[model samples]
Target chain A: MADRVLVAKLGLDGHDRGIKVVARTLRDAGYEVIYTGLFQTPESTVTAAIQEDVDAIGLSMLSGAHLALVPAVMEEQRRAGVSIPVIVGGIIPEDDIPALTKAGVSAVLGPGASAEEVIGAVRGAIDRARREAGGSAPEGEPGGSAPQGEPA
Target chain B: MTRREEWQKAFEKAPLRDADFETMSGLPLEPVYGPADDEDAEYPGVYPYTRGPYASMYRSKLWTMRMFAGFGTATDTNWRFKELLAHGGSGLSTAFDMPTLLGVDSDDPRALGEVGRCGVAVDTLADVEDLYAGIDLEKVTTSMTINSPAAVILAMYVANAEANGAKRANLGGTLQNDILKEYQAQKEFVFPPRPSMRLVADTIEWCAAEMPRWHPVSISGYHIREAGSTAAQELAFTLANGFAYVESALQRGLAVDDFAPRLSFFFNAHIDFFEEIAKYRAARRIWARWMKERYHASSPRSMQMRFHTQTAGVSLTAQQPEVNIVRTAIEALAGVLGGTQSLHTNSMDEALALPTAKAARIALRTQQVIAYESGVANVADPLGGSWFVESLTDEMERLAEETFSYLDDLGHGSMLEGVLQGIEEGWFQNEVADAAYRFDRALNSGRRVFVGANAFTEGNDEDPIEVLKITDEDERRQVKRLAEVRSRRDGDAVERSLASLAAAAADPEVNLMPPLLDAVRTYATLGEIMDRLARVFGRHVEQPSI
Candidate 1:
């Protein structure tokens, strides 16, 4: 939890009620949370994520523009040579979760998913990433490759 | 320690403890208040009105069930309005989409893809024509939730009512002409603060002369509370803003009695039941005292507080969409017992989207059940003399007074400056930061219960019912309709009127009312009118952190 899993709101979903709660919730849960304020284009989110070298990325939205936005963010992550796990939370219907996951979302959290579920899902995602990579990931140190010797 | 004890400790330990937790005017609060604390909780109809605004209160009149609605194009929302009216709603509240609020045509590039998304989209007198298609504005008391460009919107309503054969004086309505809260809370403002205040005063002055029944400005705390300020912040800032407006109208050479009686307020009923009830009582006490002491107003009506309340949409959680219904019901109860003149209960689906037709009904039913089934409304100020309510109300009033003095000593009427300084120096931001921080800390520390969120959370949830989606196409179609209005109107006349508006806005001495009326009459689109004012006043440039 050295580096926060920064959650950036992408596009024009001006309603930030849920995201703010999540951001504060995560911060209190002993993780640093950097909320890139409102109306972020996917390009900006990608750039910020790479610069921060976040442990994970969370996107909160109510706007149904997720279909257009998710693919765009995934493409940027692919081009940047980072395979970071991504999570999304909002009023996303069950049917759309599969489509979102197929588009490279690691997990989808929506209505009825509690704070504990979200936190556990996030921690579980990071842990699974570590095990799959064969070790823990290092903090985003300057001029550093992904942490080696102990983690991926 | 118990959960409450731990919370008390955390609140006491907050960095801005002296500033953050204090009342509206920054009055310090003792841990407890007894008979020695201050004074009495008088009978309901007493002078100070700390107990209740009315002698009989809800024993005589239940708060009006006014549905605040408007969305999609005017035609679409008009249908919803009629439906709401048929469902036992006592009053109508109109919510104009952004284009209308900003005085821009739906099709204008700046407003494209934004029309009819948030509220009903109205472009000209024609859309207003479309909006009140079957509804009679003269009979029904309508509330227009508009600010900044309120003068133009008000003119259109006046014109439309006249065309519909309703006498201008016979028209009863409330306009959210409060621009101070717009600058402080809701960012839906067109002109700068000073010029905006001028427009608000102009409306109050003009309405005093012509539209006697019209409450031109409803000083709003709803948006302030929504902007992350607590109950006390909402009360203090709203009352202070009310004072700022009263000062402006006085400067315009209007007597306090002439306009003060019609000055109204709007508040948010968040989930905290006792806190919200205390806020309403505190608001009445502070306003009554301020009116008598500060302005020397003699009329009882001039001093009394009349307000509309809406349940806090912020308190609703998207995590358990259905649970929001309960949240709204409790909030509604608080507003009712607080003696709100009018109320709007948010629907359960608001956490996901705009209330669906079915969900919207459930919200109305919630209010109806409270009114008919519950006996709480049968007696006046039933909880008036309760030890806890009285103590909390006194505490809130004292705190609000303290906040007002701090604001005044900071710099008289420099609201933009205060918020600018607060946001920059991290004073206000830190309060919210710390409050939100502690709230999360509480949840993690198992001191708070968010049932559907943490305690009763389920896994691998399937989809909720299909939500109504408003697409870019909705905006695109709205844009097409608005463009047609622009092309068909008397172009030369609109241009002439808009030029007059520009001239009036530039001159500080000129009361921008008559000229703006001309522009609104000629059907100057929202964008055109805002464009002219923007030239004179310039758009607000929010201060950035150093």
Candidate 2:
């Protein structure tokens, strides 16, 4: 079964070229990608993430609001009790990466991330989350099938 | 046959260099252009404006170097504005933060974590006052890149200038009050397309009567192109939107000449040198012809298409950041050759973050070098007679005309109706998305080469460039200021003004600018004014598609 991933734009930034490209990239890589469109609040994004029951969440923020917005998303994830891996991509400053990583972001992709880098980050984060879950079935995987190998 | 045969014989006798001989957009090129390729191109400032808009071009008055600067608090951005002016920038172009651009207040929950980050935070007229504290609004022309709440922001500017003793009539600048592009590309819209357009028309109508030197709408292709559109799509969609604005103003009973002269354009000077130049030349020709023949515009000023050009932000690569300076220089040169009235060169560090002060100055210096050091400005449309350039210009015109025909048929012969229907059905968005995806696929497949991203990537990893930081303190200070203004202003006056504004909004007959001015004068916040209008007009939520 394909690993389902949720992609969202949190905050008022409407620069969606990066997010749309990433979503298509993930979809082309055999992941069933769900995208929540522009101007999504943190609560709305996390709620969609939980309801969709995806394996990972990719947040795209280009408005330089990630420092404030990402932490809010993390808090929402904790409150919702969903321990999914969260990855972020956009124009993120290097100095802020430590704080974002400390806040539990699995990986941070900057602008112009190659397709391989994007896929690798998501796959690595998902594998880490699955291992942390004691190799349990992904909570919402249909028929409880084990995760399949990466598609070529 | 005599001159042509002689030139052809000479051209065939010479050895050609080993090069791609193709444009950045993959348009095939000829080795040399000659008089045979000429289409009897008009002189500069002539009808159709194919050569250039003004007779002298940059020889008499060089293009205004308008740097887009804003971040942190009003004070921070004001300081930057002063620095830019001191550093020889000819004009000011304001970049409002996301919260302000989306018409939300600093304290609004939706504005959390995004205050004054992307641009300056303006919650009320007070912020405008602080933003231009020492700058003389009359002496300097300002261009505010805000839409959706554009009328509100314009009202603030007007009120701020008046408070500072600047005559409203003498004030000059442009408002990017173009709303159709908001629905199509930028996605910063507050209300539905119809009412949002009404706001645009209201501003145009009000500006026509009051502000003589002010441009009510800067029909923009910059954001459309930035949203991953092809060069042709950018040209077509932007011109179509310009026609729609003209139609809307005419529908408001204003004469074509009365308001059309004040309408301006903004375009993107992407990395494609000849393609960008052709796009500009084609845009002016199309606009001039349409205004004169279709709209029956008699005034030459009404027929002319004047625009400001900005270097493509999307073209700036995050890798090998310094290379962006070279990229910007090439793009800025294209703007100059294409006859832009004003220009803004993107800083090298923009891909990583907002530019630091040094980076911003360097971007300005890139323009200075082109304007002064480079000899390109000495001749108006120096490439006007080139076979390659003339052919590309004609090809762009043909492509844009085809788009106009399709849109006209869709709108039942009305460009305005066509754009509205296209936005409603998501046709424009889908087209842009498909183009963007195609480009991405080409890039991934190594068919397209981006310098550091795809090819020549040795030593790509380097120390991260230092970026401008907007700290939490900026947000805190802005919110405090907002609260202070709210507490000190006359509560009754705010209510009355907002009430009147709401009443005017409900009536399609009343122009919303006067009441907007009244509300801002009473310290009514942007959020309050926008919310009041949203109650009557309703908010717009796009149907998202992949």
Candidate 3:
């Protein structure tokens, strides 16, 4: 997660173990991480995303709530006319990744993914969006390169 | 010769460290320990049994391998339970979800989304029936990891055991029935401290008579450690809570010999290796001494403090999750070597999701490897007499004693004061934040390196581990099943039991256990029992969140 990337735990999955680590890592890498505590429905998650005006929304879920939760969140984003890139994280099986991505999720992150890989994916997605929008790369955003452990 | 200056001069970094630089859970760790550390070892199975409860320890039977298991419905997790037993796990540890733990039923509105989430959802005796589906309660020991509603769940277990043709005297298991720590760390609670204490004392008194083989409560320091308290804090707080419970039970007129022997403990095995081992040794010494000196608990079993240990899940990283297996293995070793009676190794993929079957099996294998492959289990307290370990253990015991004395002087070790003043005023949370921030800063400045998280650059490899997913249909099915159980049960009997529970709760001396057992017998779901109590006790709003 970059400074602009947004992170949230979607649905009633209150397990913060994964997302907290992700947030801390991304924050250490200079990404502004927002933590939404337990029991958030998809609507609240998307609403928060729009309000934060973030560059990306990271959903850390457990509780097998992802199948119902992710689609609900995507629909909530559409209904709100917000297309901020969405990234899904948590107990996501490999088979569900394609379906999640096909449902407009920018990327899918599972367990064991290094912080660098998560950073690289979010930055690449963000950089691609900026390129399509015809905006110049933010000076300190590192031109879509993955960040190392140290903040640049 | 001030302690702070003395350590500063010895270590050469006094100016840079916090005033009380120590391991989380508050053990003041030395930069290094050498020779001259257990010169004062106490007699085993006696006062200050610093080494362990029994003289021979694992030279006796090694502590039972009880991996924590519970998820989905009772029937679903019962299947998992049988699998764990088949795979060489010697005991069963049951984990209930937030709702069931809070005394709520699966079909209750508050429990809807939470049902079968963190662990299994047990709503009634039938659900309890599903949990033991085919297992014999008389032969195998079980641990129910619950509080707040511990008595209710325990009663359910008793009823289910009777139905399965096992006498209460023959059943074996532990109910993590401790509640003082619930206010201190875990936020789940049902009644005020007074009523809660009564509930626990009632269970202790009853079990002392009816369930001779059962462990009524596992006084827990595991949650405090998990909540980021220092090792010293964990030891001190857990012991203080134990003292409080003992004092409360005394109020009910149960002799120490009757209940204290059955008391057990639970602890967390964090990443710090030597520090954790010392913490366990320190705990035994502290409890043994206090039981004899403070409460005059004379029986050897009453003096001994035995515990179950779980490898720290908080230490598991979402980044490079495979590393968690390595971490869990090391932590499990620490627990076994420290003399834990049971243990649960965390899954590598835990930082991401509920462990898929592959991850869970790997977690189990980690324990088996430690128990069999690792030569450490060949002897009891393998590092017991090491000079460094002994000295650190002494330091841990001394510090925990001082901390407990400080709390004792401030007032009684009341859970309300501890949570209301200590926690709400941010003493507990601030200490945790300070430790967390220090660790974070150390990582940022390169003082500490989390292998895959920070130093290692296998940065491109994706976490290919499969994850377990639950569906909305599961929730709907649970609700439907609960509704069916409700409609088919004798509604009039259920109402009578619920009403009786309300009356019991109204009077402090009236034991709520019998009514609770009756409610479960009448097929009351967990949520319904909780709702009835909430109607009588009303919900307790938590103190302002930090």
Order the candidates by TM-score, highest first — what do you get?
A: 2, 1, 3
Estimate every model's Cα lDDT from 0 to 1. 0.74, 0.89, 0.73
Q: Write the per-residue lDDT of candidate 3 for residues B256-313, one digit (tens) a residue.
A: 8789999999999998999999999999988888889878887979988999999987
- Which pairs clash in the backbone of model 2? none
lDDT of 1 by residue, B407-517 (tens): 666655554345434433545434444554455556665687776665666731545644556666767777788778888889999999988888888787787778877
> Which docking class does model 1 fall in?
incorrect
lDDT of 2 at B48: 82
RMSD of 2: 7.5
Evaluated on chain B only, what is the TM-score of candidate 2? 0.93
Against the true structure, what is model 1's DockQ? 0.14
Q: Which ten residues in a row have the lowest lDDT in candidate 1 chain A?
A: A143-152
Model 3 alpha-carbon drift over 4 Å, by segment: A1-62, A66-152, B1-40, B109-114, B190-195, B318-322, B356-359, B412-426, B459-463, B471-473, B543-546
Candidate 1: TM-score, chain B only: 0.88
1 or 2, which is superior by TM-score? 2
- Residue-level lDDT for B200 in candidate 1: 83
Indicate whether candidate 1 or candidate 3 has the larger DockQ. Answer: 1
Which predicted model would earn the best DockQ? 2
